[model samples]
Target: MSEKTILVWFRNDLRIHDNEILLEAVRKADKVLPVYCFDPYYFQRTASGISKTGSFRARFLLEAVADLRKNLQGYGAELIIRTGNPAEILPQLAEQYQVNEVYHHREVAYEETEISEQVETALWKLRLNLKHFIGHTLYHKEDLPFPIKDIPDSFAVFKKKVERDSNVRPCVPTPEHIVTPEITDAGELPTLSQLGLDEIVDDPRATNYFQGGETAALVQLHKYFSQDDVAVKSKSSRNSGSNNSSKLSPWLAVGCISPRQVYWEIFKHNQDGNNQNASLLKLELLWRDYFRFMFKKHGQKFIKAKTAEDEAPVLAVNELDFNKWAHGETGVPFIDACMHELNATGYICNQCRQIVATYLVHDLKADWTRGAAYFEEKLIDYSPASNWGNWAFIAGVNDAKESKYAIAAMQPKDMVSDFVTTWQPSPIDEAGDLMHV
Candidate 1:
């Protein structure tokens, strides 16, 4: 019999550690072929005239892929990089290597799911299988008390049930070494320019510099989970603009670290799971899982914001307000500060993000989809479910409660931080009277 070969396709789940797809590929195949396709779908400009993946996110991905290649090589395996559609590329690779099967982590969002279908269809004709592993969420779908179709519409009900009934599976261990056939022509990682994004200049005002890759993510996992600072629950994590809230999202977003890894570390650090900081962080992770599963349960129904039928404008002034807001030039100091931070750094505090997004939707009266689209282009940590889900939640489209901190942004003074002080706009009263600057 010919040696069985498994082609591992890396998507958002980029890490080698705690990755079920990688582990299963190693277990099943005599030789593993690791491939990452830089799908042009992500790089293309959207209808908003902004690239779907902006410079910061593009840079982060390129770095993460580069680091993944290094780690794979350290284990005596190579990452074959190719820039093109996965549907076209996977088949050619399967045919060339005489591969029997392909493996990857599954995604829930429509575009990602659609791409998976396209690749699966193409691979089927080649007489190969495209296997999907559901490894992205903290609670594995199989472990959930109910089936995906029956998942609670309310996060409160979902969280309570899952916490009571389900258990987090142990993290899969990182392989000490990986075996691969002697291969030629592992491709090169593309530059930001090659991906149709401009080279980014370092922003001095960014809260904290973010580096990409699983190696950096593991270091962060060790650092944050080990720190005894309960101040992680303070303004640092909750309200302020800086990355005091674990700074793990960027890595977490890209699958640099698995949710189970973070959860187990919290479990190891606080054996009883009673540490307030750990509990709160764990709760946020649960919220992340909620969004992913919500997408899985609903598909594209609630994920995409609907364009308003009556919001058509004559003066094109709506576009003017949007341009100003996107560039952080809005006169509203609080909202402007948040937008500035997001634009300058590809990040902002959770509350601050809500403040800006709410202002765009409720105050400016612009299309919520436009704000969502801008965040899609700009945020380095953007995930379809979380980003769009939260936007929908605030817009009152998705049935959810607005966080108190977000509600407080309307008060103006209550929400101001050093981030707001930096912008230094005129203070205003409840009546919209601008106080002397």
Candidate 2:
């Protein structure tokens, strides 16, 4: 007779610590199976033929999965690896392993929701349980002051109410006892080459050093707060491009890190008398939660042109102007600089992100989808909700009914003067190199 087991489906939450789903699986089942699937749908080309996940992010993801597997082994747990549609494969595994229930963290984006529904249908047909936990944000879903439908439209309004009315619950502690289920054979994770991508070395011009997995993320948080004196400069330098931001986005995006983990770390620091910068750090986490809350409410409409109206006007992908801007040859120094950084490194500062996105939509009169798709491909830490939500905001899609932000060349120069100087084109004699006002 096959042994009964609980399959903990590892989606984005990669760490063993503070993992609600994994911990719950341990609590309820004698045998627990850990699994991760490298869904082919992720690497496939889009309608426009561009890869959905570009090389940089692919490299980061590969490292993160490998790290997660290593961490699982330390706890005597084996990570099952597969490459295919989860809806089909998961049910097959459930039947084979006799896994009665599948536990995983909730994913709120368009594709993720659809995929989850398919998995649920498949599991239901087999009479198995699919239990999803919410462990992504600093704020728990059930603890929200309002129902998701009643989530506020304006960020200030939402933050004010949540801050005043809600409390940041302490994170679930990492269980000390871990039980690894017996399994005969587990597959290996895909490598960079197996994914049809080459390994990448960090670019010298890159501002932040980004890594994957939970340990790296926690180490970073510790270093930033304790060793690197990051807390001291929280207000002044967190906005700067070169090594300013927490550089936590990539891990968070892939579930290698949890926002609650970051929040509690900051909270601990504040309790230890590092109170001066605690509020600012907490605010950053709140912003992340805000994006997620918005996504939960708007669904796929967050990426739509008007959020409830017609899709945004589509622009030709091959238009000369579009190609130039996409390739970082816009001939505008500030825009070109920020774009070049994105090309060299898969990241751009939050401030620069807003500016370039606005320029693409409002200034160039390009479709928001074009810019949004490009970001989906390139950004290392790209979250579906945040990218699309911010794009819609800049494109006048969401709650910003009348405030359509069009980027002009002057805006870039004024906002990011030093960034322009840093990535100025070589061979100063060329007329094209000149920064036209």
Candidate 3:
């Protein structure tokens, strides 16, 4: 007879501390085995030529998994790594170990959600209970003031209601240790080449610098708050990515770090009488949670204009202007500079993201989904909700009634004054006709 145990399947919520599944699995099972999968589908090409998970995010994920394994090892737990479908691998392991329950974070993105459902179906066929928990956002799905059917369409309305009436439940406490299961043998993690990609370094000029995983995330919080010079400049200089902001998105995106951890760290600092930048930093986190909750409420629909439920926009990928916009030769200096940065380093400022996205959707008259897909391929911190939801909002397909921006000369002026002049050393002269705004 095989040993009985519970399987804790790791997904975006990677850390051990304050993780709902990690804490609960230890308490309920006689022995617990942790598992993570490098799904082959993640590295495969999309309909387009680009790899679904590009090199930058792939490298970051590799680092995050390494960090997570270390953290789990510290608790006398071992993580099982496999490169295949969870539906197939998980059920096989469950039966092989005589496991009854498989616990994991509840994912909302369309593909992941479908995969989870398939995994559940497979496990049910084996007579196992699949336990899914909400761990990504601060607001638990059950604790929401309204059900998914009732969540408001507008962000402002949702934000006001949650802030006023909804409170983030305290993080579930985590145990320091769990009984190790009889499963002893483990496999090695794949390198970039092993995962069908090549290793790459950070762009020399890019302002952001942070490693993947929980330890790096904690170190960032310490430096962001403790370093006097950097902290003082961050308030005004955050928009300038090359120097003044706390780049925590990569870790948070991969579940190497929890937003709640960042929130509590700053909250504690505020309580200790350091309030100058805490409020602003906290609001940035609120934005992250807001995008996450929006996805939860809308389900797969979050991807289409009305959302993923709606038909995909009619986008012509062969258009010449799109190629120009993508390659940083769009004739708008600021837009070009930002696009250049994103291409070189899988990161871009939030403000520039909105401007470039608007340009691609409205000015260039291209499909918003194309722009969303491109970002999904490139951004290190890309979340399914924020990337698609934002494109939908910008294209005037989702919540908005009218388009708020125009392309003519507004981009040139803003780029020259704000972004281009700052980043590009030898600025080019803008012809009079170029100032069409």
TM-score sort, best first: 1, 2, 3
Ranking by lDDT: 1, 2, 3
Q: Determine which window of 10 residues in candidate 3 has minimal summed lDDT.
A: 428-437
Better candidate by lDDT, 2 or 3: 2
Q: How well is each residue in 1-437 modelled by candidate 3, as lDDT tens digits? A: 55458899998987877788988888888888888999988888778677777788887787888888888888887888888899999998887777879999987778889899999999999889888888887666677678877776766666677778777777678787877666655668898888888678766676555477888877876776675245454544433333334566777787776767767776666765445456556666665666666677667555455545554455664567888888788877787887887777777766567778877866777888788888888888877776776677676666533332243224444565555523442122211100000
Which pairs, if any, clash in model 3? 207-242, 301-307, 301-308, 301-309, 303-308, 304-307, 304-308
Model 2 vs. true fold: TM: 0.88
State which candidate has the highest lDDT: 1
Tens digits of per-residue lDDT for model 2 on 1-437? Answer: 56558998888887887798988888888888888888888888898878788889888787788888888888877888888899998998888887889998888888988888889999999999888888888788888899999998777778888888888887777766666666676887777677766577767765466777887978877775673254353544433432333556777788776777777777776766545445655666676787788789877665555533555665654588887887788877777877877877887766567677777876788887788899898888888877777777776666633332233223665655454534632211111100100
lDDT of 2 at 139: 82
lDDT of 1 by residue, 299-329 (tens): 8776443445422432333888999889878
Backbone steric clashes in candidate 3, count: 7
Error of 1 at 7 (Å): 0.2
Query: Listing every candidate in turn, what is its Cα RMSD in Å to the true structure after a full C-alpha superposition?
Result: 5.8, 5.8, 5.8
Cα lDDT computed for each candidate against the true fold: 0.78, 0.73, 0.71
Q: How do the predictions measure up, each by TM-score?
A: 0.89, 0.88, 0.86
lDDT (0-100) at residue 322 of candidate 1?
Answer: 90
